[model samples]
Target: MRLTPFRAFDWNLRSCGLHGHVTYRPDEEPLAERLHTSTPVGEAWRCLRCGTFALGAPAAAGPADEAPLVLRGRALRDAVILRLLAAERGIRGLLLLLLAYGIYRFDGSRQALRKTLDDYLPLLKPAAMKAGVDLEHAGPVRLIEHALTLKHSTLLLVSAGVLAYGILQLTEAVGLWLMKRWGEYVAVVGTSIFVPLEVYELVEGFTWLKVGALVVNLAAVVYLVWSKRLFGIRGGHAAFEAERHAESLLAVEHAAALA
Candidate 1:
């Protein structure tokens, strides 16, 4: 029987499994040792008898548990979006803090403020009447009056709550920007806590602003839950990792070749 000469194949072995160089020449070390040093290149080896390619050993664990390039890009995009939203929350918190400060300042001049409002009522009443609104009977007007007349203890409590909430927003922003898992949980819970309030506001009075806020919050919640695989939704982290691995270039190529 005659042996057919073997030639180097045109395809790359790196995709199959070979990480580095492979030498075919005779060397001082044994052949088995040399072959052992070369990582297995699946289905890329050639036989000396017929020059046909032969399948090698199964692939080892990959370099790292990395997702597909596209999936990584998508994660980056989502992170950017979440960070931007987090920044918006931070700004909102700051604004709320400023409002709280103003309220605290007003608490000291409640009588004077009430007098001023009462004096302006004559002017406001006419415009409100023209607009078919009753300023005297409006819920917001009553609430503002109540807030202005709050005792010192009540005012301090309200201001403290606002400051604490603003700090929470800033905390969430930092966590999300860093892509910490805990941040996602905090964001979900914090945002969800206000959903009912937002819904109530919409029910009481519809406005484009309220609708938009509700929609955005709902979108963020859904995106984080589904895409990030939070709370064991869609097989949780393990399944998410598996899905990412399946999308890798090598895996895709292997499946196509098999097909």
Candidate 2:
């Protein structure tokens, strides 16, 4: 049997070796000995992240339980996913903000724009006809006409609503991009709120974009809840911390047992 060559993008491992090396010492003698060693030049300590010894004193020292639980493996994967989601939110937020600004500008200059369109539209009619284009009934022309028909108050309210939604999107982006626990909660809640609206839009008019958005939102909510163990789910905060400590403890025991 022949084995297929495989490639893997081990994010945390790469991060540890390249940029995020975490070294530590424990107060306990036996545990400390496993992590620290004598070297020709000086003392060296094992990196908690990649298990590679570093030729220097430990960056941090504390009880084994207090050692930093730097993100690794699945945790790093979670950070990458959250940041991607944050990027999506940031883009949507900016687009919504631009839309809001456009609406505000249109509301303020509705009469002038309408006058300009009316004055210029007829002048282009002959050229439009020659080019096989219906300038008067074009999408942009129809949209402008319809927007002008709306009351000023309605336009202002719509713009304000869009602006608020855009601000909310930006807030979510900040939290998720930073990978804060509160941000995860914010994203989960915010996304949950939009799921129904997305579903309604999908039901009213089926589109792949809406379907994709809906799928992403639901998946994010599930991932955050299950993996982060939020809101009393799957033993919640205590269990979450315990799991991290457990990983560190296993590493400590493995190193010490080897000695």
**For model 2, which pairs clash?**
none
lDDT of model 1, residue 140: 80
lDDT of 2 at 175: 93
- The models' CA-based lDDT, in order, is 0.64, 0.84
Query: Please, what are the lDDT tens digits per residue for candidate 1 over residues 14-77?
Result: 2223333221211223322222223355434222112224456422322222312232234445
**Which regions in candidate 2 have their CA more than 4 angstroms from the true location?**
1-6, 119-142, 248-259
What's each prediction's TM-score?
A: 0.60, 0.84
Question: Candidate 1, after superposition: displacement of residue 142 in Å?
Answer: 4.1
- Assess candidate 2 and give its lDDT: 0.84
lDDT of 2 by residue, 5-43 (tens): 534666757887678667777888889988788988998
